[model samples]
Target: MTVAVFDHEGPWTEEEYLALGETSQRVELFDGSLHVTPAPTPRHQRISRKLGNILETAAESVGLELLEAVNVRLRPGRVPVPDLVVTAPVDLDDPYIEAADVRLVCEIISPGNAATDNVLKMHYYAAAGIEWYLLVEQTTGTLRLYQKRGRHYVEHQAVKRGGVLNLSAPVRATIHPEDLVP
Candidate 1:
């Protein structure tokens, strides 16, 4: 990736944003602006890792690839790094995964960025034509699965901590919301 300085400016073009070098903080591009978030907490990381493991195993059974913290170029001027993603195999040399290759994108909501994950990112993913979007709420350990329908996403299933989320679209898997918690 080409390295350019981030000036904390607004209305950045996709080219300008991608040219910026990687920073310690997590960064995303949305609506021509850069949104930077602090590093996740230990509890968040643990939940992400556990969910990734579960998804990876299920993806492997169906010949899909499960990726964690991968930069997905949903569209020009819109790049969001989801917590976990399931996709068809991508070229190893590619700088970012194309939205077309993505089957499912997930975000494990952080307490500090709940709105971004639950609302902003959800709309972005749906607009990108991603088939499935999974939202994991950290506070309550709830898993919500959304399926794309035309220009929006509809809630397909919702499971609480004690319930099981059995998904049949994009891939097949039985996931427990409680297992996702640290």
Candidate 2:
């Protein structure tokens, strides 16, 4: 009942989530709840940087942009700072990226966040109709690429260490799984 006071359908409103602003920790809003994740390990960051470089380079030719840990508003009350996002050209002045403009969202799964990346986020991104979803599992050095299929995601490809991930949508890129490690 009190949720109506926020004037939003969800328990948390976009304004309330925005009020959180930037924080030291990784805070994602989902269904009126907050999921706070501790900072990623240095190793995690390194992988994200390397993977981002590959995607960014390829995305440029297609007029797409790769952003690291940028706020992506999946819906009115849902915002997740993905590890990397491939989006169509957006206004630099905007504080957040809209789901409609996003082509792909990448997440580097670390020790504490496997479930969130593998299940929760996949659901969110797929439901948002993001064209692609890339998941890099830190421990296994594996990469899984998913494509949206009718409001859900289906595995498009999977590669392990010493293997390559090639995708044409979002951007044409070849990624070597080994490069994602320290």
Candidate 3:
């Protein structure tokens, strides 16, 4: 049986949020609120898996770890799950990862929430002190890498389908946008 998420009135606490347990949707906590994301399309999943494999290689080469869709507690009361996260290996059993340990966060832009990924998450990740942010644009088969500058992100690289994306920070990764789709 499914439980009603909004039965109580005030903002959700970490305890109350944790009580929700696992669900079919992607749920995140942002500023004492619950944000639910629909399960991604198969095409979106394919792209995420391919890009994850590519990121895995890079992360492993540098002795870091790559995790997919894990909760990252950015601050005292904010958490947002990114599509991919890279960091120094830590205990996987922990409730959530603290942002300071995170080296990078990546989001594969989704159709309904492109702006959220491009704007909201970019700012959120930066403010959380994550050093790198990578955005994948599936519709155009392109990728953009941004490096945190103070409280915001500055574009470090933009690669289209035919071009090669070479990243030197947070890890050294070589990605070809065309390979991300299939």
Look at candidate 3 and tell me the lDDT of residue 46: 90
Note the clash tally of each candidate. Answer: 0, 0, 0
lDDT of 2 by residue, 36-98 (tens): 777899999999999988999999988889999988988888999999999999997787999
Q: What is the TM-score of each candidate against the true structure?
A: 0.91, 0.91, 0.94
lDDT of each: 0.87, 0.87, 0.88
Ordered by TM-score, highest first, the candidates read: 3, 1, 2
Error of 3 at 5 (Å): 4.6
Position 118, candidate 3: lDDT: 92
lDDT tens digits, residue span 42-142, model 3? 98889889989988999999999999998898987788889999988878998788899899898999889898899888888999999999999979988
- Report the error of model 3 at residue 172, Å: 1.4
Candidate 1 lDDT over residue span 1-182, tens digit each = 96544655568887777777577888888868888888888888998899888888889889899998878999887888899999998985676899999999989899888999878888889999999999998889999999999999999999998899998877888999878884
- TM accuracy, model 3: 0.94
> What CA RMSD would candidate 3 show?
2.3
lDDT of 2: 0.87
Candidate 2, residue 36: Cα displacement in angstroms equals 0.7
Clashes of 3: 0
RMSD (Cα, Å) of model 1: 3.8
